[model samples]
Target chain A: MSDQQQYLIIASHLREAIQSGELQPGDKLPSEARLSQQFMSSRGTVRHALEKLRAEGLISSHQGRRSQVLLPALTQDFDSVVSFSQRCQEAGKTPGERIHSREMIDAGPRLAVQLQCSSSASVLALVRVRLMDNTPTMVERIYFPEEIASHLSDYQSSSGSMYQHLVERGVEISHAHSTVTATAADADEAQALGVAPNSPLFVVNQCVYTADGQPVWCSEQHYLPELASFSINNVKERPSPSFFTPGRA
Target chain B: MSDQQQYLIIASHLREAIQSGELQPGDKLPSEARLSQQFMSSRGTVRHALEKLRAEGLISSHQGRRSQVLLPALTQDFDSVVSFSQRCQEAGKTPGERIHSREMIDAGPRLAVQLQCSSSASVLALVRVRLMDNTPTMVERIYFPEEIASHLSDYQSSSGSMYQHLVERGVEISHAHSTVTATAADADEAQALGVAPNSPLFVVNQCVYTADGQPVWCSEQHYLPELASFSINNVKERPSPSFFTPGRA
Candidate 1:
């Protein structure tokens, strides 16, 4: 077989192992020397195979350790109104939330429109970094109105889900309109997400409303591309309606 | 004002102009010297403001020319099963598709599962680049079974919508499951999409099913981040369901 074909064979074998769950996420693969021995291939060929897997995001390499299988991207439902913590738990991973900061600020004209409040209205701005399996996956900045903000005093001290907290406070989430775009991470986002500057990020700008059609909050969530994916199901009857109404509430 | 504040003021003014439709897409702004004169700011401040706009994907600069406003990202509805051509037309831009290649190949194991056919079944593979106003925006590779492929003789000669063609041939697209992710573009994708190599791309993997619940086509669409965005509306009662069923057909 050609040298390229030989390396592909080795890569396919490793890929199959990953697919079959023989090598679970976070499990380290054997050392390159051991892999070379088992594959009966040269060290260079084995290295080539590993590189192929890395490009596909199947494995990750760290200094002073063998390559490890990466957790497959967490799938987020397009139509779900669940919290990040709930989604993570549903995927069989422990979810964590670290509240970086919380402060009350005057809602600016832009935010005031989204919140359906006056510009001078006080809004609670909460910055948080969400974690899956204790690894930072996304940074979220959420703004809540004064009434809802009053109930969130214990949020910082407690590790409870925000959706649950809102529910307990008599808030009924009706729907959310989300605009999903891709952009390079800014410096603050890079630091919070533990990625290099200018890394690609999937951004979701969401405007959430209450059951009575009152806008409740606006959130901007930035997720690492490698850690999250979104799924949507589209049918013919309801042709995709554009949720992004530019400059409209 | 501080020098930094001066530039920020300039950026906000330009941003307002873009948002208000005063500066339409493809319209060139005044020269840097003129901007400096108009805003009563230094040339450095004008350049800084332009850079900020560029970072936000609002404008593009060509060699030795004033920057021009970019067409805002085209928003695709998550619930719609519309053709790209129709979407572009709705956005008031001419849509074009250039078919690069078409061939028949044996369905591989991975593709066979998606197509719900035998691995030895013949599949028609087509490669095309989608364009907006004659500028390439995305590259799509689609696979179809023989039944649909047989009626696509005019696909190459006529600039028509594939979805329309299939519908005319009695193919009723029931629904499609789409997985969206962000990744760095490969060399081939970069070339086809007219983007820099390694540029971040929004990729959508779609599996289209017919009314009989049979998978009819599979497509991989790689979009330039600057050109497209996806929108989803999640409601409380009929919440968005997760379409990603791992390890399932």
Candidate 2:
């Protein structure tokens, strides 16, 4: 095999080991010399493989410590629009949804501003509880303009994906940013999710947009914290040089 | 003022009221009709101004409720490499650091792996609690290679930004992605931040990167939840035409 191809083989094997739970979180890896010998590759090649894993968030390093494995790869793609069904499927779990409420209401001062319409206009509010592996995981309250909701009401609520429904109706789902916080499960959330009040919950406040940057949907999702942890990858910028310090830029 | 700037003027004025606490979080805003009459602009212009504010996270909308104002503005710059000092500065808060530990130590397996170095090599571990407006807000643990730390040791534990220190030594401090979760505050964190043990705290897991995409630093920041909430803005993809499929990619 080519030298470069061999490194990929090495990386894939390690990745599989991680995926299979053979190497647990916080587990240490052997030295580069030992890994090179074991993989039957040059030291540089082994290093290359390790670097790839590190970049993928599978491993971390320190100067004097053995390389340690990160916890099971529980990462969410920040750039993509991920549906509950898609997320559950990726984890090999079953996804189910039950609609709690669907109503068309007059836009009050608050929602009128959000939909960018007059208070007299109407909006459709849909609330649902999502289940993963038969256990309730999240409660979502979504609001859409009447135009969008009219196109979605006839769809099956039990298994239909609103995102997909909107998309089919030619509504472009571009991107969303969310503000997340931890909150005590209120009585309503606890009852819906089958969890006790005061249980730790993840409250995600989200605004979804269209490619043209129109606010298409807004929702608040409350998740049971122990169900899963959220993850994000970041790219940092170098600190401003002295020459580029304030007043000089 | 230019006609195109009218909306901006009204938005900025409302933003100041929200930021200065003239309008508090959860407080209702005057209706759009009222706002248009007050601002002497078209209702569409007023509505546009409100949408801008909502998009910036200074306000929130609910269908049947009043448009509630949010707390003082948070500089939610997800794209930028945000440091405690930088964040505090942006919020007009005085930032200070009290270093608790700064020493070279044996790298553990996990630390070694993250740094991609030999386990026997020394690494610098720095621990600090940061203050905003003289209130302890977060605890940060950082690790660096020995060579990098040595160059920074001259700066007293209480002085110097680690990112700045690294920059001075030609080490790049690029960007970071962070995962935020709500965890029960431990005893140590409770005392340090003067909160009760088991209080909800935001655990931010982050990795700082270099220009070449090298993972240089990993840290876990614990925040007092009452102090803030997290926020992100995202765009959704065009949903697939079929909404019933569970795993259609």
Using lDDT, give the best candidate's number: 1
Off by over 4 Å in 2: A1-82, A104-107, A119-121, A191-196, A210-214, A226-233, A236-249, B1-82, B100-105, B118-123, B157-160, B175-177, B211-215, B226-249
- Write the residue-wise lDDT of candidate 1 on A18-112 in tens digits: 76889875578899899999988887678667755653445663434687765332223422344776667666877788888889999999889
**lDDT at B57 for candidate 1?**
41
Q: Least accurate stretch of 10 residues (summed lDDT) in model 2 chain B?
A: B237-246
> Candidate 1 — which pairs collide?
A79-B240, A240-B79, A240-B80
Which regions of candidate 1 are displaced past 4 Å?
A: A1-80, A157-160, A238-249, B1-80, B157-160, B241-249
lDDT of 1 by residue, B1-249 (tens): 754468768977887787688988557889999999999987756876675555344566453677766533222332234467666666677778888888999998988888878999999999888887888887899999877778776664333378877777788765666677677778888788876676777767888776445677899887887787766545453324332221111
Candidate 2 residue lDDT tens string, B156-218: 534335666666678765445455676667788778889777667766666766544455677
How closely does chain A match the true chain A in each prediction, as TM-score? 0.63, 0.63
**Model 1 RMSD vs true structure:** 24.1
Q: List DockQ for all candidates.
A: 0.14, 0.13
